[model samples]
Target: MPDLNPQTVAALLPATCRKVFVAYSGGLDSTVLLDLCVGLPAFAGKIVAVYVDHGLQAESAGWGEHCRRQAERLGVDFELLTVDARASNGESPEAAAREARYRALRQLLAVDDVILLAQHREDQMETLLLQLFRGAGVSGLAGMPIASAFGRGQLLRPLLEVAKVDIQRYAQTHGLHWVEDPSNQSSDFDRNYLRNEILPVLKQRWPALDKTVARSAKHCGDAAQMIEAWAEQTLPTVFDPTDGSFNIADLSAITATQLNCLLRYWLRRMGLKPPSQAVLQTLVEQLVCGRCDATAQVCIQGSIIRKYREKLYCIPEQCLQKEVQTNPWIQEQERIILSNGYVLSRSIASAGLSKNLWNNAEVTVEPRRGGEKLKLPGRAGHHFLKKLYQEAGVPPWERDIRPLIYLDGRLAAVAGLWVAEWAWLSEADGCYQLDWRASESM
Candidate 1:
C-alpha cells in the first residue's frame, strides 16, 4: 500500500540539486523511477536518463536504443555510455560489471548533479543478507545508503524505503513499457539466485521481511556513522598528512578496537576498499609489532601498507616498481609528470635555484642512482645522498623514488629537499623552486 508517487520521490531530492540523472537500464525498476522523475514539475527539463551499456550481452546495443527511445518519448535527455566489464582472474563478473558501470556513471556527473538509482527496500534487504553471509563488519552490514557523495555530485536512492511490489504497481498503473533483461532470470548470479529462490521462501514466512531487514540495516548504518565520527576525530592526532603516514608510537597507544576502526576509516578515506578482518589483523600485527629493521608489509588489492622508520605508509603497488628512467625537462615546461604517478613542478620563489641558470642549462629528472652526491648551501663539502637522506629522516622506499633534478649532467637539486650549493640562490636573486608532489595513491 506504499505510495511510489512523484511527491514522495520529490521530497527525497535535495533542494540545491542542479540536475537529475536517472540510471536507466530499460528495466522495470529504472523505468518506474524515470516515470516518477518525469512526472515531477520541478524536475521537468532537468532530467536525463543515462543508460550504461556494459556490453556483456549481445543485446546491449539494442537495449541502449530502447532506452534512448523511451527517454525521447518522455521528453527527457538520454545518454549512452559503453564500458568494458570483463572480469579479471579470480574476480566476479557481477562485481566487475558493477565497478565498470559505476565508474562510467561517476565520470558523467557534473557538480551538484544528483544521480537517482532504483534500488528499493527488497534490494536493501538482499544486500544486508549477503553482507551477513560474508561475515562483514558494521559498515558492510549497513547496506546501501539512501544518499552519499558520488564523484563531485550526490547519489540518491529515493525508492529505498518503498517496496518492489509498489514500484511494479506504479509501473503497471502508468502502463509503462520496459525491456526485460534475460540475465535477471538466471540463477548463475548470486543476487539473482537470492532474489528468485531464497528471498521468496524467506518472505513467505516473515511477510514483513523487507521492512524488518531495512530497519536493522538503518540501525547498523547509524552505528557505523558513529564509529566513523570517532575515527575522524582521532585521525589528526596520529596521522601525518605531509607524508601520508601514521606514527607507530601514537598508533600503539590506542586500544585494539580503536586501531581497527581508525585503519578501516583511513583506507576508506583514501578511496581504497578495506581488507577482510583477518587481513586487517595481520596488517596490524606485522606492521606494528614486527622487528624494527624487518620489512613488514601487507598488500590488499593493488595498495600496500608498509612499515618504515617507525611510520606506517599506505602506497600503491606501482610505486614500489624500481625502474631507472630519465626524463628530459624542457626549460619552458613548468611540470613533469612521471610514470610512477609523481609530479615535479616548478614555481617562482626567493631562495631556490637561480632562474637565469635554470633557463640556460639542460635539465633532466631521474630516480635515485647509487652513490649520488650533493653539497648543501651552508655545508662544508659534498655529501653522499645516502648520508643526507639518513640525516633528513627520509624513508628507504622514498629515497629510491624521489625525483633527482640534474642540470647540465650534474645533480643540482634533490627535489624540495635540498638544492646543491652551486645552484642555491640568495633572496636578491630571482629563483625557481622545484617541488615533488606525490600521487593520491601514495
Candidate 2:
C-alpha cells in the first residue's frame, strides 16, 4: 500500500494552504491523488482539478475529457487546458508533449495558488538516474523537490515517497476508472524504457531498489546545498561589482562542479530557462578556458553570454533599441544610452554628483579595440585601451565588450571600463556618464 494515504497527506497540508489544484491526467497515479485529496480535511472547500491536453497522441483529447468527467463524478471543480506540443533542437517528442502540458498548467494558477502532482518515489528514482546519466551535478541528482516554485505559484509532489503499485491498488480499491497511456509501454520514451525494463531488473537484483535510489538522491541534495553555500562565499571574491552585477571572472575561478551550481543558481535567480549540462560545460570550456582575447559567446534562454576584452557581457537575443548617437568625427563611436533600468546604472550613480549625467552628455560609445590609446588631459603618457583596462583592475575577459568611449577617434571613456581622467565628473564638473541602451523589456 502507498504510505501517502489521504490521511498522511492531510497531516502535511498547512491550515492556510487549503486551496489546491491537482494535475489530473486520467492516469491511475493522478486518479489516486485526486481521491486522496477529496478525503483530506485541508481540501474541504478548496480543491480544483486540471487536465492538460497535450495534442501528442491521437486520443489525448479524449483522455483529457475522461479525466474531466471523472473529476465531475468525484464532485471536484475541473478545468481543461489544451496545448500544442512542439519540440526543436534535438528535443524528444515525449519531452515536448510534457513541456507543453506543464506550460499550460502553469498559466492556470495564480501567484498564491498551489499545484499538486502525482510524482511518486519511482519517478524520483527515474529523475535521479536520468540526471546522473546526463552528467548532472548534485542538484539534479537531488530529485524533484517535494514542493518548489513554478511560474507564479508553487508545485507540490506529495507522492514523492509513495510507490506506483500502491497508486494502482488505491484505484482498484475505490473502483476509480482511469485511462492507461499506451506510450508507457511503447518503449519509445526514456522513462518508459526504465519503467518497463531497467527498473524491474534493478529491483529484482536489490529488493529495495526504489528506497536505495531515493536515499541516494536525498544525499546528493544535501551535499548540493553545502556546495552552494561555499559558492555563495566564493562568488563575491572573483565576481566584480564595478558593473553592479556579477562578472564571469568569478565563474572562471571555479571548478566545473562549482561552475555548474552557480550557473543554475544564477538562472533560477533570474527566472530564466536553464541550459543543459552540455551547454553549460561548453560555456565553461570555450568561453572561460578560451584565449583571453578570443570573442566567445553561448546563448542560453534569451540572453547571450559573451567574453570580449577579458570581460563578459550579457545581452538580449534581440537587437535592443539603444541610444546610439552618430558622430561625424568618429565613424566607430555610437553613443549608446542605457535608458533600460540595468543593474550597471546603479554602479554609475555610486560615483556621486548630479543625476543622469550620461544621458545629458552626447557620449561616444564604440566597441573596444586594440591599439586604441588614451591620452589623459594632464597625464603625459599615452596608455593602450587594453593596458588601461588591466591597470584599472578590470578582468581580462571583460575588456573587449566593455564599450570604450571615443571622442574624435581618441578614447574618452569606457562604457563600463572607466571614465578617462579628463572625462571624470569632479566636484565642479557637471558632465556625467551612463549607458544609452533603451529598454528592450517590453
Candidate 3:
C-alpha cells in the first residue's frame, strides 16, 4: 500500500504555496488528511482547516463543530462556511451539494494558497467508472486531476494515488476519530450505489482493483493532456477570443474528429461545459454543413452556438435576453456600465467624433429602436442603420443590442461601428472614440 503520510503530501504540494487550506469534512478521508498535514513541520503555522457546511444533512452544524475541535486539537486555524445545497430544477441533490460546497470553497481561497482535498485512489476509480458509464470522453475518463487552478489559488489532491485502505490503516495506527456521514450509505446517489453495492462485489474478485483502475486513469490523463496541448496550439488559429467565435473557413482542412476536439476545447475555455457526443455531432452538422443562409443554432447547458457569416459563435444563454432600455451617458464619467453588463468607454483618437463637439454636447446611450440613419464619413448621403449593419456584416442578433450613442437626442455614433459624418473629425487635434465591450455572457 502507498504511504499515507506527511512526506507523501508534502511532495505533491507546489513549492510556491503560501498557505495550505485543508478541506476538513469531519470524515475518514479528510480527518486522516488533516492529521497528516498537522504532522508536517514546514506547514506548522500556515495550515488552516476549512469545514464547509453544505446544509444538506441535519447534523451538518454538529459536523462543523467536530471539524473545528479537530482543527483546534491539531493546532491549526479553523473556519466554518455554510452554503445552501438545495437542488435546482433537473439537478440531482448530490450534484447540487457538490456544486454549492465547491462554490463556497472557491470563494474562500486567497492568491498562492493551496486547498487540499482528500480524494484517494478509490475515489479516482469510482470517478473513472462513473464517467465510463455516462459515456464521457477522455477528459472525464482521466478522472480527477491531482492539481488544478482553483479560484485565486491552487487545488491539490495529495491522496489521489494512495488507496483508501492505506488511509484507514494510518488512521487506525494514529487512533484518529472521524464522523460517519449517513448519506454515504444511501443507494439513491449513483456514486453511493457504485461504492456500496457494485464496487464491493468487483473488489472481491480483484483485490488490487483500485490500483489497477488508477493506473488506467493515469494513462487516460496522459492522453488527455496531449490532446489538450494540441488543442491549445490549434485554437488560436481558428478562434477569435474577443468575440468568442470561431472561423468556419479555417476549419475546412480539419477532420470531423479534430473539429469536435476544437469545439470541446473552445467551450471549456469559455467556462462552459462541452456538449455530449450526440449534441456535438448535431452541432457540427447544422452549424458547419447546413444551408449557408440558414441561421443554425444548438443550445447546450449554459450556452448556445449560433452560425453567422461562416463563423460559429458560442453565446451565453443569459445574453439572449431583451436588451436594456436607453440610458443617459455622462461624458465626464468617460465610462458607463450597461444594466446588461456591457461596457461603453470613451477614449481619445485621431479620427472619430469631434472632441470639441463631444465635450460640449450631452450624450446618451440607447438601444436600437429601428428606423435610425447615419451618414458615412466619406459617403455622399445618409444611410439606414439596418443597411449599414448589413453592409458591415454585423450578426442580426447583435444589431438589436449594439449601443447607439446619441449626442443631445440625435444619433452621433454606433458604438464600435461608425461615427456620423456630422460628428466625424479628420484633421482635428484629438477626437472622442467610443468603444463598446460586450460582456462575457454576450
The best candidate in terms of lDDT: 1
Which clashing pairs does model 1 show? none
Off by over 4 Å in 2: 1-4, 241-291, 294-303, 308-310, 319-442
lDDT of residue 351 for candidate 2: 46
By the lDDT metric, which is better: model 1 or model 2? Answer: 1
Model 2 Cα shift for residue 299 (angstroms): 5.1
**Between candidates 2 and 3, the lDDT winner:** 3
At residue 325, give the lDDT of candidate 1. 87
lDDT of 3: 0.87
lDDT (Cα, tens digit) per residue for candidate 2, span 1-442: 4355687566556556646889998888888889999997647668888988777789988998898788888888998888888888788987888889888888877867788998998999999998888887677899888888877778888888887777777778888888888888887788889889898888888978888899999899899789778867766664544442345654445677766676666554444666787887887787666876544677777776766654555555543323334333222233333333322232334442233434444445465546877765557787887777767765554454355555545556656445666555554344444453324462
Error of 1 at 39 (Å): 1.5
How far is 317's C-alpha from truth in model 2 (Å)? 3.9
> After best superposition, candidate 2 residue 65: deviation in angstroms?
2.1
TM-score of each: 0.94, 0.71, 0.95
Q: Model 3 TM-score? A: 0.95
TM-score, cand. 2: 0.71
Per model, how many backbone clashes are there?
Answer: 0, 17, 0
Best-to-worst TM-score order: 3, 1, 2
Cα lDDT of all candidates, in order?
0.88, 0.69, 0.87
RMSD of 1: 2.0
